[model samples]
Target chain A: MELFMPLFIAVVLVFGLIKKVPIFDAFTDGARDGIKTMLSIAPTLVGLIVAVDMLKASGATDMLCGFISPAAKQLGFPEELVPMILLRPVSGGGSTALLTNIYKTCGPDSFAGICASILAGSTETTFYAIAVYYGSVGIKKVRHTLLAALSADFTAAVMAVVCAKLLIKI
Target chain B: MMNLIFAAMIIIAVVCACVTGKGSELAQGVIDGAAESIQLLITMSGMMLLWSGIMEIARRGGFTAIIGRLLSPVLRRLFKKLPKDSKALCCISMNVSANLLGLGNAATPFGISAMKELKKLSPHSDKASDEMVLFVLINTASIQIMPTMVGTLRQIYGSREPFAILPGVWISSVCALAVGLTIAKLFCKNGGS
Candidate 1:
């Protein structure tokens, strides 16, 4: 499965070769368009990065963790994951940092470690994706996109905890 | 709504930083964040260019159409509002394929292009169409077969089998996708009413 990506790329390239497509010219054209798209999206990306950075640096996750850890423990979720839960939806890198920390402290086979790993895999940084994808198109009236995405994130987080406990044998 | 979230995040950051006496850290983080964003953009540009070029080849060689044919049934159900032969659906088909394969970086170009194509069909130019909303929701809740990013991270942290949680990730992601799509469908219907 690890080789799946490289194999997929090879197959695509081989098929393109067989089709007699001008692969180089096509690639450059597409690349140029990608750069143009990047330029158009730069401002929104930068703004989000700064805000997320500031939010992380403010220790807001820690504060939230303090408030929610007890309730989380009561509900069978690991107390250590409160900070991760608070940050996961808003910032992928932040939750990743927390995840690495969890892995380091508890070992990868520990309940907290498996749960954190599963959560990272199963969900996305909802706000970041919404902002980048929707903002790129200049869509302002996001309507229910946020609500639906957040609900998904919420579901993933809960499932991660349950699945890790039930299946991970930790 | 975007503005509100942005402002709220900034305000919360500022107030929390000031109260916690981490003013200097906050100041430093701003610079680091700006630099990271630029770095991320550069990396994204390179990846996007490569994939875009590959996709261009695929499009020219009729490979995208093959992919479209394979994914059309699922895409049709998800984006019923789109015409049967719409280019937007083709773009979406490619995007969903990339996402499922855990090639999210490659998927974004197709996703952005899909939105652009969808935008052309919208009666309200500034507002998202129902199809667009559903697309965004699906993308956010993307179900990955490999979940390679997380697996790689677990490997770095010395897991015996980094992909050991694959089943858990697959099950949870599928669950999230289902929950998200259901909510999106309900919202879409209410909007129609």
Candidate 2:
């Protein structure tokens, strides 16, 4: 991973050089630009983090688990998957925490099942994505976007489960 | 409350923007703080540029085109109402491309672009058309080939190959996307309101 990081950076450096722009200047500017953007997003991310932390701490996740686990089993998803599917629409970081919990309980090479579960967690929160992205862009035409995004998330969650169960052997 | 979000953001930005009442020499520390973040900024920019390069190579080298062509058969049936060269098609392609590389950050712009394109074909602006619904379905459940983020994490932790989970990743993504599309089609016909 450390090797990949530098290699990835090298690829960018080479590409930037080929494009004939100043390297150090661009790098500094790019860094400065990143800091500015991070500052812009710092509040939202912090608020989201706090909200999710509170939600999880308050047992909202457990409530969701109770609500969704039976349905998930009916849908052919495992009980463990319920948390990920439930948590993803609510919080990516929270889902990450849940995934760590799963890994600790089940182990990583619990193979295809674990793999599939994690994939679902890595997916975007369709509803939240629409809310944040559209909200950022000042969009009012949200009725369709919301439906569209939610539909996508809902479908992806199902597919992630099925593929994990049947397609990959380990 | 909706527009108030922007107002709140502006206020926050302004508050963060203002800082100094201290003496001039002491104030240098305030301005100096922004400089430290430049290193991380450079790291991020470099990461993004690499991913863009991967996407460029993929698109420019016909990887995306081949993938598109491979997908065209099913996409044709699934999205029959949309034109062959529609902007929605382009956006879907872009979204899929970004997703494939595990660049969710990069995919957002493409997803929004596709939505805008889909909106043009929408009837009432309040309702998603059949095509819009299907487009969202497939794009949402879009199969992932390489799981970059996961792979990177595994690699960091010293997994043997790091990407050994590729087969499982591909299978789950394909199955998920397929079932999602089928359900969307069914819902579009009988259940949409």
Candidate 3:
């Protein structure tokens, strides 16, 4: 897996050389464009990240998790994973913190810990993706992207627990 | 829509903080969050530049085109709105392949480039087209073949088999992608864009 990247780079560069492409000039041009892309999305990143951080710091995430625990339990979702699932689609840092917290409280091989790992692995930060991708192009009206992404995240969260229970012995 | 969501998040956080007596932490979060984003950008910039450079070479050398052609059978069904030979298709294919390889640092550059091409196809410069929304949906669904970060974290936490949850991860990822695509297609069919 580690060698894939180096090998891919070598192949691309070698291919570029064979094709008579000015690799250095092409690289610099793309890097310049990359800088521009970064600058354009910087404001969006700041706003979204700050909002997510504030939500976490305000203790609302935990409170919401508590509020949703009963319904989540009824739906067969593990109560211990409510917070991680809630934060998964919004904040990567927040969810990772919750995952480690689970590891600390529950052994890493335990159901909750394994479920947390699977959930974290299978879900992307939807809000961050939407913010950066649309923000880069200055797209304001995202329409149904949020709804679809969140639906997928919810599915992934459910499937994580289901798969963990079916696959893991403990 | 985004404006409202952003405003609502800030408003809810402030109100919740005031009610919960977490005003200080909230203030610190706001300050630190902004700084942390910049820190993240700095860390990511190097990879972003390298991947962008590599992608540029690949595109110029016709490698991306080759990939686009190979993936076109699958990509064509997903991005029905795009022309067969659209530049966006090539970039999107590269982005998706990078993601599948778990090269997240490499994926972002290709994704951003794909978004640029999609934007060119958008009738309104500021509104997201259906294809753009679908592309974002695919990315946010977590399609990596291996969850390397999770495995590493599991190993750090002293798991006997760090990658033992691979089956679970794969099942969940496939489910997420399937559901996300179905929902996106349904929404697009209703002319939600």
Candidate 4:
């Protein structure tokens, strides 16, 4: 994973030099565009961050987790993972913190811990991605993107738990 | 739609906080969340700038186009609406490759650029095109050849074999991507944008 970026850069630079492309100028132009894109998405990012953080901080997440724990358990999801699963699609950072908490409280080898890690690895933060991507492209009407993304997240979560149960002994 | 979700979340949080007597905590959270967002923006800006730069060089050097050509056969099947040699295909190919490699920092710029490129083909710029929705779905459930973030987190938390879930990651991601694409295809009934 660490090698991917450096290797990618080296290959691009070498190829650019070989092709005599104006690598420096192209780089600067793209960089400028990158900053502009970031600026464009800032408002959306801030809104999402505030919403998610407020939800988590208000203890609403914990309340929701408590409400879902029984059903989650009946469905074979580890009770400890309710919070992570809930937050997984909303906020990447919130889910990561929850994953870390699970690992710290329950040993990383535990079923819940393993499942949480896999869940975190497998899904994207759907709402965050939608906001940023659509905002960047100036698309106001997002038709089926949200539905598709959340369905994917649900699939990943279920698969993550099932796979963890099958693969991890503990 | 986005506005509705945001409003619902804020209302839920505020109501829940009042009921739970956590108004002060909620106030602190709002400030902290805003600050964290800025920090995230700065960090992401640096990463995006570097990757956008490198990928631009790749674009100029014909490497991205080469990737686009190689993946064109498969991509054409998925994105029939796009021309075989469309610039959006190049960006999409690069974005998918970056995603598979677990290069999240590098992937966003390409993904954003791909959306922008795809927008140019959309008859209704305000509404997402079929191709755009498909692209977004695939990206949201991107297949991970390397689950770098999870592996690192596991290692940090003292898991002996951080990559033990590699098979699980691959399986779940593939499943998610497959289901996501199928659902997205259902939504794109008109076909070809």
Q: Which numbered prediction scores highest in lDDT against the true structure?
A: 3
Candidate 2: where is the Cα deviation over 4 Å? Answer: A1-80, A104-106, A111-118, A129-170, B1-62, B157-161, B189-193
- Model 1 lDDT, residue A87, Cα: 73
Overall lDDT per candidate, in order of appearance: 0.77, 0.52, 0.80, 0.79
Model 2, A1-170: lDDT tens digits are 33554565565566556666466655554445444544554444444333333333334444656787787668677666665665565554445444544444455445433544446533655556545444443455443444444554665566566555553454
RMSD of each: 6.0, 10.3, 6.9, 6.2
Candidate 2 local lDDT, residue A2: 35
lDDT of 2 by residue, B85-150 (tens): 877877777676666655455567887787777777766655556666565554454355555445
Docking class of 2: incorrect
Query: Could you give candidate 1's per-residue lDDT for residues A64-133 as a string of tens digits?
Result: 6688878988898987777677678876655655675577668776888888988988888788778878
The alpha-carbon deviation from the true structure for residue A95 of candidate 3, after best TM-score superposition, in angstroms, is: 0.6
Candidate 1, lDDT over the whole model: 0.77
Q: For model 1, how does the per-residue alpha-carbon lDDT over B114-139 read when each residue is reduced to its tens digit?
A: 99999899988788888998899888
* Colliding residue pairs in candidate 4: none
Candidate whose TM-score is highest: 1
Candidates 1 onward: DockQ, in order: 0.47, 0.10, 0.47, 0.46
Tens-digit per-residue lDDT, B1-193, candidate 4: 5567678889999999999999999999899878976776675577667766776677678664565467668888998878877889888998877676555666789999999999998889799988888888877785766565566567666877777787788898889888888888887867433
Q: State how far residue B112 of model 3 sits from its true place (Å).
A: 1.2
Please give, for residues A1-170, the per-residue lDDT of candidate 3 as tens digits. 34545677898899999999999999998778677766776676677777767777898867876988899879877777986787688777557556755775686788888889999999998988998899999999988888889889989888998988887764
Q: Write the per-residue lDDT of candidate 3 for residues B36-130, one digit (tens) a residue.
A: 76776665567666766776787688764575467779988888878877889879998887677565666899999999999988889888888
Interface Cα RMSD of candidate 2: 10.6
Off by over 4 Å in 1: A1-67, B1-68, B190-193
Ranking of all predicted structures according to DockQ, beginning with the best and ending with the worst: 3, 1, 4, 2
